[model samples]
Target: METQNYIEYELVDSVSDRNIMTDSREEAIHAFEKGWTVYEHHNTINQHSKFTQSNLTVTMMWNDNPEFQGS
Candidate 1:
């Protein structure tokens, strides 16, 4: 049996709720630096690995208009 180990990065867009998967660490770091959420996953054949969130952002929205009733 042949075994392989690799790491994958998931770049997420919080606003759009979208995800992009890639094998390039550079690409993941770049996306994270640009405000994209990042997740890291490690994979090994026949073995369980760890999944981690590398970056996160919290967004808040406020409505100052009295006429605005959250519809």
Candidate 2:
């Protein structure tokens, strides 16, 4: 077996702590446009002969006005 890499987008309401995952940038943007904050998450899984390790990476893209708070 080989290492597997994965990437995903997250649309979050920072204040409310509500979030959803998306498969593409476009979907993330759309969610952000609808008053949700957007984030890009990258994941890497390394497989070894004995065990595996997984790492997560995240980046903030867009944030809506705090006043709105996912209205």
Candidate 3:
């Protein structure tokens, strides 16, 4: 399955803790930890932005879901 299943929302301005949504009881936490590590290395904080800011930008293309057209 693709993680592109949902719209990649701009998490920059979001106020809520991402960990909450990511918490599938410790399992999800661990998954995210691994993913976050990759995410950090992949999107190093340049003189530009944070990991979530650069990497979490909305994907204009979705998984063929009409509901995510603007995503």
Candidate 4:
């Protein structure tokens, strides 16, 4: 929906520019949440097959607000 939301350009009064972003833990948490939300089925899942260690786990890359890009 976010991708298509820009269709009505006039409705969007203004756009904001952001510089740098820093991610605390939301990146990892958002991925985990998306997987379980069947209603929103917009999903992201990661597998660490190369990491044979049992302790290894998949984590989503988080970028803090402003830039919305990976840190």
Best candidate according to lDDT: 1
Which candidate gets the maximum TM-score versus the true structure?
1
What's the CA error at residue 55 for candidate 2, in Å? 24
TM-score of each predicted structure versus truth: 0.58, 0.48, 0.19, 0.17
What value does the lDDT take at residue 43 in candidate 2?
57
lDDT of 3: 0.28
Ranking by TM-score: 1, 2, 3, 4
- What is the per-residue lDDT of model 3 for residues 1-71, given as tens digits with 9 covering 90 to 100? 53322211122122342422221224433443445311111112211112333543222223344542222
Off by over 4 Å in 1: 45-71
Q: What is the lDDT of candidate 1?
A: 0.57
Off by over 4 Å in 4: 1-24, 36-71
Per-residue lDDT over 1-71 for candidate 4, one digit per residue giving the tens place of the 0 to 100 score: 44421110001111232222223234333433433211111123211111112432323232223221323
- Candidate numbers, best lDDT first, in rank order: 1, 2, 3, 4
Better lDDT candidate (1, 2): 1
Candidates' C-alpha lDDT: 0.57, 0.52, 0.28, 0.22
Tens digit of lDDT per residue, candidate 2, span 27-69? 7666766667665545552211100122222323223334323
Q: What TM-score does prediction 4 earn? A: 0.17
Is candidate 1 or 2 superior in TM-score? Answer: 1
